[model samples]
Target: MRYPAVAGMFYPSNPHELIEMIEHCYMHRLGPKDMPSLGCYEKPIGLICPHAGYVYSGPIKAHSYYALSKRSDPMEETTVVILGPNHTGLGSGVSVMDDVWKTPLGEVEADKEFVNLLWRECEIIDLDETAHLNEHSIEVQLPFLQHLEMLNIIKFKIVPICMMFQDYETAVEVGYFIAKIAEELNRRVVIIASTDLSHYEPQEIANKKDMIVIRDILNMDEKQLYEDVVNYNISMCGYGPAIAMMRAMKELGYGEARLLAYATSGDVSGDYSAVVGYSSIIVE
Candidate 1:
């Protein structure tokens, strides 16, 4: 089993404290301002959420999960495919770990069978856990899903993919095979693209750069998004995951995308001098 890597740092280590933090995020001024209900999920697709401390990105991250709570296709057997950027260059260029991921809330099993199937099909995919050991990008997303699980709003398995190499060619290829295999296996899925935008820039500069990246995401233009991030020199941490999710969504025949919320650490810290940008987006 993979244990909580950033338990006390990114979020609370105690279960109760973590639960309280999650509830507060849903009620934060920047968040949905209320808790979510057990509504039907009619069209399950993909989501883009920032991975940062609860104080900074939690409220914005809440927007994506809140939207998920609102709609999907009657949640049956489902798998959430998480794509995150590798902060520590520890393992494979592209890897997936087939182990149960534990958080303060509890354990969420990995779709080990699906993970293995995915490995067989894509030569680029690695079943390595080292890349995820100290990676906060993917770890921080669990509690949100766990919160929804505790609410009984949804039940799920996960396929966590970490990309050490975020080049356009590699990202697109990994995404294509993911969708292809899921379809072949007849697996129902919801994709999570985990990323944070424009690190430690002035609020104005961060906003400007992040908006350019978010626009391409909302437009579902993976190729254009990848190019813009490079050409514009946007320091988005997970552009590769964002592009991968977009490609997977397109392959599944889903089109429309929406920006749920966008904010930066400056909004909460009240320090506009420098901040990291965060955004919540959903594609269906």
Candidate 2:
């Protein structure tokens, strides 16, 4: 498999260093001083996490994975389906992998049966491995799963979808369809919306914009979320995926969402002039 794009720049090319870094991040927890435990659930439906680098987004990422790990089910029964934005503009719709996705930590085998099943059901799906080649949106979340040991036992498959030519209704429809399949099959699946909030803006402005998006999302108001993005010109990297996740979570019986953590690149780099926002949220 040719792993192209931002391999060395976004993350370390050396396998050992990459593993060490992910492990280190896992060791350090992030969140409120009095954060409550996530506890366990039968089939936790969705997660929204940032896709920034380990240094900038690592703590927030840790909060996400740690919450996931706190769930009751053993790792073996969990199936992770990651939906991310298409930064490369290569794949127009959903793209599923036919083989294992290799990272510096190790290889994550694609659940071929599920991938094919999705393609058969969804008209907009395709088998395009190249779509994932250079996309850090999906890759950045792998190490967190790996460090939690969820990678080894979980019967997980990655569906790297790039939403294009689709509206909020389309995202809702697709999300409901996936939820129906999971219910019918009696499978425990987890959906992850890989995204970041506002892009390069002053810290204060970025915070304001991100809060608007977050409020809409927490209220389960997909239309308001879209409107806020369009009205404010908020450049959130994963708005499509976030909309889809909200739709799917509602279908799967989750009625509430809580913001787990929120921060920005400025918090890490100490630069307030230009910053990108990061947030971790859970649907329950």
TM-score for each prediction?
0.97, 0.89
**Residue pairs in candidate 1 whose N, alpha carbon or C atoms collide under 3 angstroms:** 41-71, 41-72, 41-73, 42-72, 42-73
Q: Which candidate is the best by TM-score?
A: 1
Task: Compute the lDDT of residue 87 as modeled in candidate 2.
Answer: 82
Q: 156-255 in candidate 2: lDDT tens per residue? A: 5555565653467767766776677667666677888889999999999999999999999889888898888989999898888888888878888885
Tens-place lDDT per residue, model 1, 1-284, is 89988999999999999999999999999999989777775655899999999988999999998988876433575789999999998999999999989887889999888899888889998989999999999999999988888887888899999999899988898889888988887888899999999999999999999989988998898989989999988889999999889888888889689999999999999999989999999999
Q: Please give the lDDT score at residue 66 for candidate 1.
A: 92
Give the alpha-carbon lDDT of every model.
Answer: 0.90, 0.74
TM-score of candidate 1 on Cα atoms, chains taken together: 0.97
lDDT of 1 at 115: 95
